[model samples]
Target: MAAASGDNPSKLFAMPAIVADRRDDGSILIRSTTPLKASARCVGDWLEHWARQAPDRIFLGERASIETPWSTVSYRDARGIVRRAASWILAKGLSTERPLVILSDNGIDHALLALAAQHVGVPSAAISPAYSLMSKDFDKLKSMIALLDPGAIYVASTKPFAAALAAIAPLHRATIVSGNPDDADALSFRTIAATPESSEVATAFAAVTPETIAKFLFTSGSTGTPKAVINTQLMLTSSQQAKAQTWTFLEQAGEELIILDWLPWSHTFGANHNFNLVLRNGGTLYVDGGKPAPGLFATSLANLRSVVPTVYFNVPRGFDMLIAALRTDDELRRKFFEGTKFAFYAGAALPQNLWDALEELSLQTVGRRLPMVSAWGSTETSPLATDCHFLAKRSGNIGVPIPGTELKLVPSGDKLEVRVRGPNVTPGYWKAPDLTAAAFDDEGFYKIGDAVTFADPDRPELGLFFDGRVAEDFKLNSGTWVSVGTLRVAGIAALAPLAQDIVITGHGRDEVRFLVFPNLAACRALAGLADNADAREAIGHAAVRSAIGQGLARLKAQGGHSSGHATRALLLAEPASVDGGEITDKGYINQRAVLTRRAAAVAVLEDDGASEPIGCAG
Candidate 1:
């Protein structure tokens, strides 16, 4: 039998057809015609080889224009372009080790150079160009820019970005592309690709092998400055290999597999999770030029409606918005999931209701619901660690360890911390050896930090569920420990209708309290308020929300934690902000940051007017 994730784990060893040569690391090297040497090659190396092998296949780029039947740059052409650009950069004495920085939004040229750079051993660092300028930390961004001292900077030929880069990278090695040219900088991204590098890029890509540093990506965590994560070509290659059994994604016959993605390029899910999958399997990706929650779904529905992607990946909010559109517009729903093979949701926990809605839509169109997978991983794990298959109900569990991975649950403070050891795991945070050492155990498995409860391991139905962050859970005054992850999931599920976001309170004292973010969408609908009518809608929304507020209060009253819990006070206004440190880029709340920022809310929960936080609850 094929190694679909639906197989029983106990029977896996007996099935020799699926299992391959066993490794010392408790992982089986499954059989594949994909070159064994190419197994761990960096992305650039992989692509360069593919370019030579299958030059005609589509490569890294958007389609010619809106009306073109074919979209994006094909692989063969992508190599040629990268080679030209690589020659331009290299001619300027660009070193392979000191990365080239991409300070722009997601686009075709952005992807091409990133992969191409990896082929030649020069790691590419793509930071959120938007996040760099005019923020609370200009130096913080400058420090990131300084991290690589980027020998060269590649800017999208577009406006604000082109204008922004001019201000951001003054006196730095700069080049411009005519494709999105807003400013007259040094060179064009596409025009430079037209520059000749026939011998240069081909020579570079062949040398970048398993150990070559593919990417030098950074992740901003709750604790400190954004630490860099070093990824090897092997890690990127293995990541692609691991997904072979989970998706028939690579099984498309001849037509290019199309993908329209709006997820941020910095995040693992947005970058490697979707992009790498499409790249490895020889698929075409359409960079959704719009942002999400609203901008993306409409474009995505339009793109997927006709093109029919081999796979689709969206966040929970994206799915929610799509459901709303689908419920009202059947044609959109039918077209949205039309030729879709499988779907994936990441970044946040998807409620059962949202998953149910997606399933209903899929079942209506295709007669059988397509599998919508949820993957779990950290930046340290090169992003995707575990992915659940869609054979059964959407359990929201992050499925089994992929082919080259080994998992363990180490009992830590008050919970068992999930750990994994695999090639996919980074070589540790860049320049943070001590931090990396502490991140793992004596056994060398990287400690995942979050607490997780072990589920079925053999048949492993819902592979494993994510508990809250190791730091989020706390105990009551009575000393009964409460898991923030569990409480949040339960609380959100209970208050799904009225919930947008909820911050559980009362850490040291009595029962747990919360600062909730209301479902403004639901509020708007219930209050009959239009989007732009903030003033007029607020008057009506206040009354409608107040009534719904009482319902939420009652809902929280019933859904207590461990015991009969009550939310001492919940003030609903203002969405959480990433810039303000209320949340991470991944949308995971910084509990400590929230606690410090909303000191008054916590104070109100403890002792209302007389406490240190008199004006806390807003």
Candidate 2:
């Protein structure tokens, strides 16, 4: 059952009716009316479909700058290139043990290479470029190299990753492929693209089965070193069918569906969800070079000015940056909201302030508010188990499951642990049999480790809000449990744009405190400081401290109990360490990683005399 449905124009983006099957064990199964059935078994099937049906259509696009023209790829052209690349791949004799490894940002080359590998039986692993470019010790990169022992490694340029490549060169016997010419040993990407197609390429593509492992995407390593999650053709294709059923707008739009995405292909959100969704629906994707980070967001803003997409999707942080642009730039706002039907966010729970701000912007620009949607899933679930297709009244509404997937809510300690069983879910982790065995329940459902609570207990179809991970939540000194995920969203909303993310402290302590990571750009803007102000100087400003203090008072004023409010807080200037697993490439903060890395800072928050605190109202 949908929350509301009537003649209201603003409710044009209303939710679909939910079909539920409730069990006696407090476990519930929710799904959509639209059945899930794959039109194509493998991803390559869709590529071939569009190539034959709409050969001249643009499948993917990218640009170097605002002034530059987009370099486009047609479906027909992509198929030819993929076949040629596959022939070259077959020449090298790639197998499961010696797979293809890509270490670079997203591009046409990256997309074609991934498609080529999956078109055959070889599994392609897109390792995060951050590990190679950002890390100082390269310990994580070395570990990954040891685990994969790739048969081939591809990078956009040899110059940027030369040191990282050299460090791991002796570890594995991988053939190097690079787009740029700096590396002497690496094969040229252009040369591979020029390889003639072979008859064996068609046989290899046709032989791919549902059980064939198509990709190996590593987890975010939020709590520890990343584990390689095996994504099969069944997992990826079934998930897309579920999506096509729920989000009918994609099918309705036909080949007209357009998207601009910057999320990394290394992660499932970009690779499986966004990228695969476009291919499945026969749409065009503009590979956005801009990211949510302040410096890089300018590129995103520039891109938006030029191209307005039909369906927009990003993480909450990206919206945070985009909202600021929407508020002041009328031309950008008009272009963004005019053709956009829905805005989707994942990778984190969105703050309510950003939610409200987007609705208001839509109403102001379009004379009607558009739907802001989101879903809940993980890298293992093909990243789409539940999707919110309807117009939710507020934020944090992860609607019922898409068709073909069953959600089993098992009772945990005062929380419901969400488990999933379906073809869309991954079978296991790569090479980690024990970990894979431990990840499932007795009935074979994957134990996702997340907790959920219904929006309305009497109405199962209304949707569910994500509770904190069962392991991340902790009991206070008073034995009251603190839901870190719930409270984090509330705190971010209370602090508005000032606090980008808050690490809830006071675990097993008398009360909850916060180690606040200030959104330096927003804080600087609020403080009327120079653009180049250092983090320390920016966060120490009188205006910034006052805004945070006010936000704390507001949280305390609306508190339900001790765990619901932060009694003390401290602003931190040091950003989250990527190597320490405190932040993912997708801009999601790992609460557990932050707590572990900033243990001393949290300790100081518990002691009033140790640091100057932002006091809460009693």
Candidate 3:
């Protein structure tokens, strides 16, 4: 590994001694030898600690628009506001049975309302805004509302959610609360924030325990309807505690941590991992209103120019977008690397090309490459099962199990299926007793359904790499297995700048194939088309098809087997649909959903006579 210029290696990472225990049955258990320290009782404890320790420090910052200045709230002020809001929530009869549900993006108001609800033992469910705003039918939102049976529903504005609210109006009698004071049909957020702090607020807060449900975060629903993953105070607090232990620099560095993040609070990566980490460490969180989409990424770049974060957190897609901006914009690159400890990615396995680009840019601008690291876990684990405390030699290393967690690697055919058990792990899915019971093994470990392998089999301390999902792997007619997650990442890297995301096909067929979602910008550039050229015109150009054919051929040359290399690929014009369960709000592609939804497209690839596919050369 190359040393980071002008950076002390000792201060940059915590090199914990990982211990792996090999079982006689070909299974393995791994964990960091470092013990987890005592954690806070609940999420409110962290807020209280920060409120007292850094009373005047800016806890949260956000903007109303691109042109507007940031509006910040101090820790002390946040506590006061939370207390008053908690009193109002308590008076509203919101409890475990009738939790608080939020239907808005990340903002100061949204944060305050969630904190208030959690502070008073009222679990808050932050549903993805896309479910309400993007979906025409609102079927997912209605189902979530029915499951939650919330006492109240909150939205930042009423206009965008008017249709969704009306869609679920017949399902529940929950009170509606809007951030916009002008919404006459709902109670105002501003009024609730200013509600008188009653004695009941303190009583309710004192009653909160470690096992108390802090929030309900829904899964991406890749296979079926999204399940409500119960996040307890213990799960949240212990996860952060394990993190602080792994990344000792957060406290050792003595600098106030600052982050500019756009990941939605609805997802565990953003909520329990990033958001809670900031609060636990008394850091300032700039709630970016941007996303990693086409028009929205420009806003993220704008925010990055203004705020040089101490640490940056994003998914592979977000980093991919940011890398493009950073390569050309010298000013943005310099600012982004300056005062930055490292860059973290999750949500999907990052393509090696993207990782190489980021390192190259960091070296060019900062004279040293920043540590690009990742962790592996799901919403049910409070999202922090493993931590890459040391710099990984490759792109996909998810490191070792964090201090309180135990990873049981049981052999499942060609892969090791990883199961997790710890205080950080969720008990089960909310309101579904069957799912709760079926989620665990006989020994009480949460069956995460993901597979992993040792980075260095002989040297257990080197950590592990994320293998594809167990359910995603399929057998060909020759009885060979194809790892979808591994192949997808490799394919994206091999196709570089052309394939944005690829879905593997041929579950029981003789060979693997790809349903690629082409990157329109790159295709247009390759085809020598105008920036505003029609999507079909650009993608169908001879030059674009030739380039794709060459990429596919190149991928085939780096041979493994028929299951490893995709024999043919078809470029998709229509993007993955959020309502169809083809994609998640965080930009992760659901392979099964995509294949099931686009059966005709799959049939096209399976047909030898289909001329649309770019065939791989022998």
Best-matching candidate per TM-score: 3
RMSD of 2: 2.2
Candidate 3 lDDT, tens digit per residue, 168-272?
999887999999999998999999999999999889999999999999999988666899999999999999999988888777432268989999999999999
Q: Local distance difference test, per candidate?
A: 0.63, 0.86, 0.90
Consecutive 10-residue window with the lowest summed lDDT within model 2: 1-10
As a whole number from 0 to 100, the lDDT of residue 181 in candidate 1 is 46
Off by over 4 Å in 3: 252-255
Top-scoring candidate (lDDT): 3
**What TM-scores do the predictions have?**
0.85, 0.96, 0.98
TM-score of candidate 2 against the unseen true structure:
0.96
Write down the lDDT that model 2 would get. Answer: 0.86
Q: Give the clashing residue pairs of candidate 3, or none.
A: none
Q: How big is the positional error of residue 351 in model 3, measured in Å on the Cα after superposition?
A: 0.6
**Tens-digit lDDT string for candidate 2 (480-507):** 9999999998998888889988988877
What lDDT does model 1 reach?
0.63
Poorest lDDT segment (10 consecutive residues) of candidate 3? 1-10
Name the runs in model 2 displaced over 4 angstroms. 1-19, 22-24, 32-34, 181-185
lDDT at residue 58 of model 1 (Cα atoms): 64
